[model samples]
Target: MGMDNKMIVSSSPHIRSIESIQSVMTDVLIALFPVALMAVLLFGYQALITMVISVATAMLVEALWLRKRDIYNDGSAAVTGLLFAMVLPPSPPWWLVVVGSAAAIIIGKQVFGGIGYNIFNPALVGRAVVLVSWGGYMAGNIWSPPQPFAFGADVAAVTGATALADQGEAIQYKLSDFFIGNVPGCLGETSALALLIGGIWLYYRGHIDWRIPGGYIGTVFIMGAVFGGGFYDNHLMTGLFHVLAGGVMLGALYMATDMVTTPVTPAGRLIFGIGCGLITMLIRLWGVLPEGVTYAILLMNAVTPIIDNFTVPKQFGGVNKSA
Candidate 1:
């Protein structure tokens, strides 16, 4: 009897998809390429260099922290690195890149027990830390104006504010320029067209659901029309501007939809998105800062577990307690 072997049984969900962490992360990198390409095209080779340095730094930090030689091969560190870089101003110094990358992997991700266990989005955490630590590079007088493929020393040395940064009525950007990504801003926030292309590609591949982005953007559009842009040109353009102007497109499509830190249930996802939109507009309209996508999404990420608990659906054959 002691020599007899017994089969071990495990929990149901006994089934699984063929997809691995590597494949999903690879798809995310592919989706981000259009935005990265647009960043380089608008900002110059310096933008590309920042992205490379950030990615390398993230991979190195994660490898060293976890003592896992294959960490880079998972593609997660690369995704975090690029996402972190996309949010930075064009051509920040190499030290900022290294520091933010390490913080993202070590503090933001690994400290929370890595990947699936993290409460906040690691890239956003990294960005928030760096933005606070080095406000000069993130804001103030360090931004390089878009050069549009000009890689020479023709880079703009003078500091300038983004359109949102200038809250005055006399903002100088043409709507077309912002849409096509000609204005100066963070590497990813400048181009709505590029982000949309990448977002659509991700959606078509079934990598993301429509509910989260739909809720977040729909709420923003409504709020913008109700509160912003004087009624002159049908007011729709004003609403469109809110969606296109800053990181709304990037946040709604990519960061807010992070599967690891967001809700799993459909209704919960909608609530999470709406909550993000509400917080973002509140900050943009009334808070001191011009943009609020990063903090808004991170806040909602902190609430995702609660959202899931409240939004859990009833079982197929279960009767309501009150019934």
Candidate 2:
């Protein structure tokens, strides 16, 4: 046989798609457009400013770290920055945004060796840092109400608690408000409608797995319906409220589904999602914080390797360890 006809076997991953990291990250950014647009429409220019600063800081930090002139390296830094902004208050101090974005790219990402090597989601790491360091700004009754296309409006003037805040037996806003994202919350987390649209786009592109989101949202709904007090109309509605409110939609569809940090095995992915939901509900119900999506995902991220090890399927005709 000719040399050209001979088999040229290489290591694993012989079958690879044409996709690159830049392409994958670009798709994520496109999917997040609706969430970003909704943030601006709901919270006005302040949200836009927050996104700009965060994205700029993240890209700048990564560029400087790698000693590369290309600020948009693989586009992962931009995604991390935008996601970090999504978890933030609509109008947090500019300095805080810069610090958190930088932290996300540095400590959360590069410190672990960058992108696919990082164990935790960079955006959540940044948010967790800010939340711990500046709890007053990140939590409490500081959420700004949406202005609904009032681009020039000052949202900060009318601050209030989110629907998820522990306020006894009555939800403050209508279910419609939560679905439409008119209620006060984090910049991108308010609008379930927007997130659903983005999720659909990601799904269509085959960028995400339904098992993770399904298991996560299903667990949250079940736990909410069972344990959540019948605060809003009925237990069913309360469960639905849990699904639509705060970062449940965002975390389930986006953060928890991160390709790099999450597991590769299907079973591991499902378990990861369920674990995230369980921890999030546990924190929201019993922990000190009103929101728990960030920490829940981070904690699950730490155990991803263990989950994958046990969940990986045995190869065909492979011998059993006990045998």
Candidate 3:
């Protein structure tokens, strides 16, 4: 009876779950598979090449640097590599793929103390570095135009500016085109349908919540409708365009919702998403860049800790205001 009455304490880590890091990474990779497949179907062999190179180099770098015999089993490097490739222009030279993958693992992940310790998303860190270093390759006519549903066919060598880059009287894309990925942009970001499929998969697995993306996409829709061109004639259409075009869909779902970089509290997550949208729109409109998802999410990532600190809920039974 005394033994039962006494408090029982086991060693640390008593609570456990079936989920493992490998399982989580595997799910993310699986979710990414359709998007990656769409990238290949639209952009052709160049996309496949870039993905392979990035994955290989990222895994190699991580294993060599850490001297981990089973680094591949952890599955972080593969996810980072695939993500880095997804954000890049599909037609980059082989050397660029190697360089960016190495940078992602070395500077982005390991330099910040690896995996969970990195402040910014590791994949975005690599992409930002590559973009800054080789602006000509990353933007300004480097994008390979998507060939609509032309799977297993020869991808014609064509280059075009993205829909977001066209700030004339109006952007030159229908909602259907964006949905079907008949546009020019990064390999993975062009297809709204693909991204939604992946995001839905993640959501179904209970890996993500809608709040981050909901706040992000909602803010962009609202802001674009108010300040965007052609809103007077077609407010609803204009709002839909902003939501469908460019990297907003991909960024809101995949990049901004990164578990390690985003906030822990619900309010903080919403605020983070809103901040990302605000910065993204500002850069897209006033700033020189046509797309701002990368920098916006990265900037918000830098402030996640502060957001969490202030937004943390009060303890369960203590500090009652009406006590």
Candidate 4:
């Protein structure tokens, strides 16, 4: 008999993407540079320190969990950790951050069978867990930029102020300050310009599905404008402030674009994004929380699988009731 040697290998789509998981993750990190640099510039060294601590903690937790679980050759943990660090407020204490990172790596990722298998965005789940468990600590937004170089020693001793200190009672910033990230908030969330630059890069690279961000931002604008009244400059300004602040840009560009946690089809993704936008606006206008992007994303993440099921590509010559 002729020597028989055949091998069978199967993978997704049968068509290869020029992108590897590591490369995609790397590109994401690169795209974030502009925003990260801007955040550091506006918020100071402490912001950079926060990012480093969060990312480091995330990486350590992810690696340890993977080692414990016996599946040890994926780069996803690094991505999750980096993304988590990018969204956290600068004032988060080290211990709370460590807890969040561990939650992201362990319960959010490895426990779900790693990487692509997770049902939710690991970073968001981790952040959410911290938010629920340590509401007071996590809500501390007292962050300040490095004192000017001339101020020297004072820089080390400065305490950060709260982002929402003047809200309701009085609006302390112009719409412009909020848009430029001059007003206090999460370190990374201050600059709409920087986030937009990063978003444009990701869109150019085709790494992101623009529908999600577009729909999300657009829906928020329309809804916020309607409730707050009209899309004229003043109303639009308020909407812009809301859109550019907090984790809106970060979530739209990074977390909301999570391939595994978001709907696969274009329409489904559009619907998911619109829902996020609507919920964010509703919560911001009337809910207890001042910002709602993270919670909105997580709430929608729960519905993504259902969206995918309904939006799956139609079988050839089959009924398309899902339409």
Better of 2 and 4 by lDDT: 2
The CA lDDT of each predicted structure is 0.84, 0.91, 0.85, 0.71
Instruction: Mark the 10 consecutive residues where model 2 has the least summed lDDT.
Output: 163-172
Residue runs of model 4 more than 4 Å from their true location after superposition: 1-15, 68-73, 140-170, 229-233, 313-319
Q: Cα lDDT for residue 57, model 1?
A: 93
Residue 154 deviation, candidate 1, in Å? Answer: 4.9
Q: Please say which candidate is ahead in TM-score: 1 or 4.
A: 1
- Per-residue CA lDDT of model 1 for 1-323, tens digit only, reads 75587766799888899888889999999999999999989988888898999999999898888888886678888999999998898878889989998898888899989888899999999999899998888883346668887875445475577766664421466678878888878888789899989999889878888888998998887777777663324467667677777789899998998889999988899999899888888887788988889999999999999999888876789765211
Span of ten consecutive residues with least summed lDDT in model 1: 228-237
lDDT order, best first, reads 2, 3, 1, 4
Candidate 1 Cα outliers beyond 4 Å, as residue runs:
1-16, 140-142, 154-156, 168-170, 231-234, 317-323
Query: TM-score for every candidate vs. truth?
Result: 0.91, 0.93, 0.91, 0.84
**Candidate 4: Cα lDDT at 162:** 42
Deviation from native of the Cα of residue 107 in model 2, angstroms: 0.7
lDDT for 169 in candidate 4 is 21
Candidate 4: give its CA RMSD in angstroms: 4.0
Q: Which 10 consecutive positions of candidate 4 have the poorest summed lDDT? A: 145-154
Q: Compared with the true structure, what per-residue lDDT tens digits does model 4 show for residues 11-107?
A: 8678877788777777777777887787677666666776777777777776676554522234566667667766666546778777887788888
- Residues 163-258, candidate 2, lDDT per residue (tens digit)? 777454127788899889998899999999999999999999899988889989999999889988867789998888888888999999999999
